[model samples]
Target: MVKESKLLPRPEFQRRLVWSRDDKNHFLDSVLRGYPFPEIYFADGDVNLETGEGTQLLVDGLQRVSTLIQYFDGDDNLKLTSAPTYRALNEDEKKAFLQYDVAVRDLGGISKEEIIEVFKRLNATKYSLLDIEINNAVYAGALKTFCEQIAEKDFFRAHNIFNASDYKRMGDLRYVLSLVGTMVQGYFNRDDAFENLLDRYNDEFPMHAEISGRLQNIFDFIEECGFDPKTRAWKKADLFTLLIELDQVLHIRNERLQPSKVLEELTSFYDGVDSSGVNQGSVSSIYYKAALQASNDKINRVRRGAIIGGILLELSESEIREKLRVEGLA
Candidate 1:
């Protein structure tokens, strides 16, 4: 339909194409991977009464359908970063890609004004969408794709870092984005810097290889430490803090950390926090409180990172306590 001009991808009233090459690459990747995307919507267009032929105005999914046409035509503009391009795929894969199903809705014989209303209504919503959802829409580029790849690594899978709700809402992407973002530019409160990071690295993430290496090292080091599944280090918030701090010590600070020492100290500190109870004067109690309350806030994140970093440095409990006390944190 697109090739024969029976279906129009963009009518004059439709928004201009704003997808980056990176965005197109990732979308193509999804299609090649057989991942389902949201449906497209179309409305009726002019009919050639004598010929019994009619056209359809693409009311929604302009980017997706346009990408598909470009990929099928083997357009050079649609480069493959992580997925095989159409010409590169084997015969069976090419057949599968060509046969991929796309869900679509057609609004039959609607007037232009009704088409406009339908488009607006399709996009309208009373509830606010999450930041991850907005980012997923606007910046389907390199950084986002990198995070998506990292989120699928065996380390995260084995540790069960993400829950079902996280997967359902792209929270896994956000989580890995947060990890990489914090590694590059230290902690900020609750995804505060995610959009900036996503936009800044959308075209090309130059640190992709370097960051991947560093993250793999961190994951391996964490695994070598061999903390039990019951350890708080496996919990989301604590795991986040541990990874951030360990990244600081091992990568940023260029300090060596012993796996056995890390395992022993972290286990003890996590257990201390777990058993600290209401003992407000203890460092473990303070760390425990911060981890439990508004944990994503800059102050609490800093508190958690400092304690964990110090532990990774093989600091004594008393020394860690004194440092926090001097900083008026404990």
Candidate 2:
């Protein structure tokens, strides 16, 4: 025969009430409307028994059970009443709830440890909770909120420039922030000091607001560079080389090292190569050599010719010959 047990809350189980407002409302509406729901399971133990008679402690489905009790007995407001309502339940109401026959199943005298293991497996399988999303949602303080905002607006658009598969593989928005941080650090005197100053400024003044703006401009420039913006197929190594050339050009041309100048130079380089009918496989190779020579103030005629020659080697002989004659490289 099936052993009959009373519905009770477990003392050891603290109710976390993790359900969102929408989730709670929908659950309550379903129950009140007599809509069928999946059977609520409970992991029975000494904790449930210790709470004594009349007051049934919930082992699982605390939010659902609590919602029902509150709606039926207390105020119908349903906004998870802040004041304690459980202790105020009268004798008749308490008896009615206790007598409420919920389908109860026993684990056939399973050990406490075994029961816990079963409970964990059941919850894990049922919810399909993502640990990272849960952690971010649960402790969603200031930084997490800021990160989420950046991701939704800036990161989402920027990442979509690549193919869908590549974007998903890149993981979260933090990686993009880290890359931007790396670039920002390159401009300052002391990297740590700059980071500290930025953090302090963000805390006091609203200077960090510019970060989102800067990121938008950066992505815009990347789009104009003729590389597939969505897949970011330009490659990180290529970007690094391009950044070096951009920095050099900005310094030499007495231009501000801002997003606009960066974009202009990047677009110009690609346009120049395309117009010249240069068949260099990777523009990065040319930019790398140019950056190296520019850094040493060795960008003279001879050095330029040598760099151009190296770039041409990557092209077919006929194409290189034609490009050489056109550019006076012959």
Please report how far candidate 1 places residue 103 from its true position, in Å: 14
Q: What is the C-alpha RMSD of each candidate to the true structure, in Å?
A: 11.8, 15.5
- Superposed model 1: Cα runs more than 4 Å off: 1-128
lDDT of 1 by residue, 1-330 (tens): 988998999774454455677988888888999999989998889989999899998987888898898888888877767777788889999999988999999888887767666665665563234677656656768998899999999998898888876775677888899899988888898988988998999999999999999999999999999999999998888999998998899988999889998898889888989998755777788789889999888888888888888888878789988888787777
lDDT of 1 at 51: 95
lDDT of 2 by residue, 228-247 (tens): 45322253433433433343
- Of candidate 2, the 10-residue stretch with the lowest lDDT total is 186-195
Give all TM-scores, in the order shown: 0.65, 0.30
lDDT, residue 53, candidate 2: 35
Model 1 clash number: 0
